[model samples]
Target: MIKSVWQGKKTFKAQSKFGHDIISDAPTESGGDDNGASPVELMLSGLAGCTGIDVTNIMKERLNDTTKFEITVDDEREDNTSRSVKYVNLIFDIEGEVDLKKLKRAIKLSVDKYCTVAHSLKATIEPKLIYNGNEEEL
Candidate 1:
């Protein structure tokens, strides 16, 4: 479970079930103290984190290289009041001697089969790959 307490000036102190605290705040323009990441940012961060973990575990089990890797999540939002998200992009930047096929399979499994956070979202997710600085497919 998660609990969020309103800190003054459009900020919230949210605690996860595991007792980790995350400070959510609005930007200065949004009448907040600019103390931490906004809720939307945190949500995106959660997606990245969930997928990252899944891929890491899968790679480890498959005996793929785990030297260097990073996941970047990006979303496109509407301009209206709701600011509804249109789609999300999960970019995987990987370096070192990793097997491309295995890496792609691991990412596909995470995005389509194992990631709870990805399954929970309502937007389309496009997964991209960059291997050793070169863009690759799926």
Candidate 2:
């Protein structure tokens, strides 16, 4: 199981079962030292990383010569009252010689099947695929 310990005010040191530790801190204005990424930021990063990992493996197997890859996670948060995330969008920027259809399929597989973080999040996430420079709907 994963564990998170309060390191100090508005700061938490999260430990993974795999032996990795990451720090989460609120902004200085919120009482933290602003030393590390906030928990929400880490959550987004984790979601991106999960999908990225799946896509990378699929690329290798398909022999896709992808030169650049980036995932952007966008969402809105309700901070004042309920303090919850509403909607989320995942934009994939992929470059190089890759089959657009296969890339889209790979992404679908990631979000729909492989990426646990994607399914674990509370908000519904829409995956947008961009191949080369054109946006494609799958």
Candidate 3:
């Protein structure tokens, strides 16, 4: 299991065999040092990263050449509750001459079928996808 020690003043050092120590914070507005992304932001970021990875990998497997995969997530909250992310909108701008059908299918599989993080977060959050380019709606 991973271990972390609180170093005081909104700084905690965590270590795992996976990689480097992670420094987390509560955000400056909430009395943190703003050292890293707040937890909620991290969650959204995880979703984006997870889906992006899956999409890229799938596209590569399909022999689709992509110039870049740009994924952005916007989080929305309700009723002023700070702990829960109510909605998340994901926008993907996939550049290149790849077939729109393949791109859409890859993204769909990532969000709806393959991505573990997306599946885990499906209940608590809503994810919307917007594709920039000629990708036809699926």
TM-score of every model? 0.83, 0.80, 0.77
Model 3 quality (TM-score): 0.77
Candidate 2 local distance difference test against the native = 0.86
Return whichever of 1 and 2 wins on lDDT: 1
For residues 1-138, what per-residue lDDT tens digits would candidate 1 score against the true structure?
A: 897899898999999999999999999998999999988899899999999999889888554545667888999999999897778999998887878898899899999999888888865768678799999987
For 21-109, candidate 3 gives per-residue lDDT tens digits of: 76677777888888877767767887999998898788885545667768999977876755466788999987778888988999999
The CA lDDT of each predicted structure is: 0.87, 0.86, 0.79
lDDT of 2 by residue, 14-115 (tens): 888998999999999988999799888898999999999998887675645767788999988887776677777899997888888989999999999989
Lowest lDDT 10-mer window, candidate 3? 126-135
Q: What C-alpha lDDT, on a 0 to 100 scale, does residue 65 get in candidate 3?
A: 63
Ranking by TM-score: 1, 2, 3
Candidate structures ordered by lDDT, highest first? 1, 2, 3
Residue pairs clashing in model 3 are none
